[model samples]
Target: MQLSGCIALVTGGGSGLGAATARHFAASGANVAVLDFNAEGANAVADEIGGLALQADVSDEAAVSAAFGKAITHFGSAPRIAVSCAGVGMAARIVGREGKLSFDVFEKTLRVNLFGTYNVMSHAAILMAELDPLADGERGVIINTASVAWQDGQLGQAAYAASKGAIASMCLPAARELAQSGIRVMAIAPGLFHTPMMEGLPEEVTAKITANIPFPARLGEAREFAMLAEQIVENPFLNGTTIRLDGAVRLPTR
Candidate 1:
C-alpha cells in the first residue's frame, strides 16, 4: 500500500535504521510514530519528523500494548505499517572463557529480540485487521529486522543468532496467518550497518568489518534499509519471506 496518508510505527525509531525508516515514511507523507525505550531519543526524532513519540519496553506485552494504544489515540488509528527494529546485541560463546555462557544473557537477548518482535507484530496485526483493506485487500504490512548472523553465526554469537533466527523462521507462518486479514509479514536480514550498536568498536575494527563485504565492501547505510522497507510496504506480492539486505556477504566463523 502507498505510504501517503497512512500511519507507520517504527520501533527503535530514535536512531540508526529505525530512525532512517521513520524519516523516510514521514517524507512519503505518512504519519509516523517513533517508539523507543529511550524517551529523549524518541521524542527528538518525533519532533524532527512531526510525528508522535512512544516510550515502552517492546518485550513487555502490557507496555507494548499501551504504547500502541497511545499511538492510536494520538494518530487516530493503528498504523498501516509497523516495523520491528528494537533489538540488542550480545557476543558470548555458549561456553565462555570463564565458564558456560550466562543463562541470563542468553535469555535476555531472546526476550528482547524474538519475543519483542512477536509482541509488536501481534498487536499491530490485531489493529490492522480491524481496518478496511486497500485496493488489493491489503490492510497493512509488517517488516521485521533480522541479521546475517541468523544464517551464518560466527563464534560467540549463539544467543544473538538464535534470537534473530527465530525472527527469520517465523516469516512464513506469520504471513500465512495474516494473509486472510490482508496484512503481510516480512523480515529483513541486514548485514553490517553503521548504527550505535557498532559505535563502541575501534575505528580499525569497524573498517575491518566493512572490508569483508564482497562488492560494496562497505557498511550498509540506514537509508538503504529504509528504502527496502518502503519497497516492501508498497509491493503487495513481497510477502512471507526474509530479504537479506547484505551485499552478498556471508560472514565466516571467527
Candidate 2:
C-alpha cells in the first residue's frame, strides 16, 4: 500500500480530521481529492496541496456520483483509496426534558454518520474493483471514521452513538465482502479530539470531557488521526477492524 502516486479521495476534507488526512496524504506523495460540503474549504485545501476539490453532500447519491465523476475526469482515473470522514455529531436523549428527541434528529444523525460512510465506501470500492490489483493483488483501501461513543455512549448520545456504532459494526462485514476484490475496509473510533466538533462545545463541557482521558491529559490532535490512517493504508495485514484513536480514554456515561 505505498501511498506515493496513489489517488486518494477524502470526504469532509475541508476541516478537522478529513482535512488533516488529506494534507498528510498529499505530503506522502498521493494525488488527493478533497471532497467536502464546504466548497470554499475544499477548494482551499485542494489549492494548498495542488490536488482536486469536489463539493458534495456525502448523503446525497447524486452529489456523491458527481463528485467522483469530477475526480475521475481530473485524475484520469478513479480514486483507489478513500477515507470517509464526512459525519455529524448530535446530542439528544431518547426521553428527556425535550419530551423525547425528535425522530428527525435521530434520523439525520444516522443519515450523515452511518449512511454517509456507507455511501462513500460503496462508491470507492466499486471504482477500486476496476483497477488492476497492485502488489499482493491489492486494489485499494477504505478507512471509515467512527467514534468511541459507539462503545460507551453517554447520556444524550443515543442517536450519535447509534450512528457511530453502526459505522464500526459494518467494517468487518464490508472488509470480508470486499476482500475478494483486493480492497480492505477499516475504521477509526476517535475519542475526544481538537476537531470543530469539540471546539463547538462549551468550554466547560470540553474540560469535563478532557479530564476523563487517562493519559496525555489533553485533547487528541487531528494529525494523530491522520497518522493512523496512513498506517492503516500502509499496513496490508491491518484490515476489517476499528482502531481506537482515543489516547487510552474511555468515555463514561454523562
Candidate 3:
C-alpha cells in the first residue's frame, strides 16, 4: 500500500526493530503512532518523528484497544498498516537444574510474545476492516515479529521458542481469515539482529554468534528489518507466510 498520508501503528516502537520501523514509516510519509510499554522511549521516538506516542501493554486487550482508539482519534482515521514488534525473549529451560519447573517463565513468555502479538493483530484487523479498501481491495496489512529461535531453540530457549514459533505458525491461518476483509497477515522470523538484546553481549560472545551466519558475518542492522517491512507493505502479493530475515543462518543446537 502507498504509505504516504496513510496512518500506521507500530507496537514496541520505543526501541529496537519497532523504533526503526516507526521512524522509517514516518519518513515514508505515514502518520505514525508509536506504542510501547516504555512510555519514555515511546515519547522520545514520537517526539523525534512528530508522531503520537501511546503507552500500553500489547498483551492487555483493553489497553491495545484503547491505544488504537487514541491513534484513530488523533489521526482521524484507523491505521492502514499495523506492525507488531512488541515481545519478550526471556529464556528458560522447561526442566531446569534439579528439575525446577519453569512453567512461570514459559507462561510469561507466551503472554508477552504470543498473546501480545495476537491482541494487537486482532484490534488492528477490526479497525482495518472498517476502512474502505484501496487498490486490489486491500484495507490494511499486519506484520508480526518472530525469531529464528522458534525453529532452532537453544538449550535455555524453550519459552522464547514456543512463543515465537506460535507467532510464525499463525501467519497462514491469520492471512487466510483476514483475506475476506482485504487485510494481509505476515510474520518475520529474524535470526540474530543487533537489537537491544544483543547490545550488551560481550564481544567474544558476539563474535561466536556472528561466525554462524554464512555471509555478512555479523549481526543484522535494525534498519534492514524495517526495510523488509516497507517492502512487504508495498507488495500486496506477499502474504500468509513467515519470511525468514536471517542471513541464511540455520542456528546450531546449543
Over 1-254, each residue of candidate 3 has an lDDT whose tens digit, in order, gives 98888899999999999999999999999999999999999999999999999999999999999999999899999999999999888877788889999999988899999999999999999999999999589999999999988789898998999999999999999999999999999999988999998999999999999999998888999999999999999999999999999999998988
Q: What's the C-alpha lDDT at position 50 in model 3?
A: 93
| Whole-model lDDT per candidate | 0.94, 0.93, 0.94
Question: Model 3: C-alpha RMSD to truth?
Answer: 0.8
Q: After superposition, how far is residue 35 of candidate 1 from its true place, in Å?
A: 0.4
Better of 1 and 2 by lDDT: 1
The digit string of per-residue lDDT tens for model 2 on 13-44 reads 99999999999999999999999999999999
Backbone N/Cα/C clashes per model: 0, 0, 0
Task: Estimate TM-scores for all models.
Answer: 0.98, 0.97, 0.98
Worst 10 residues of 1 by lDDT: 93-102
lDDT of 2 at 4: 93
Candidate 2 has an lDDT of 0.93
What lDDT is reached at residue 218 by model 3? 88
What candidate 3 gets wrong by more than 4 Å, as runs, is: none
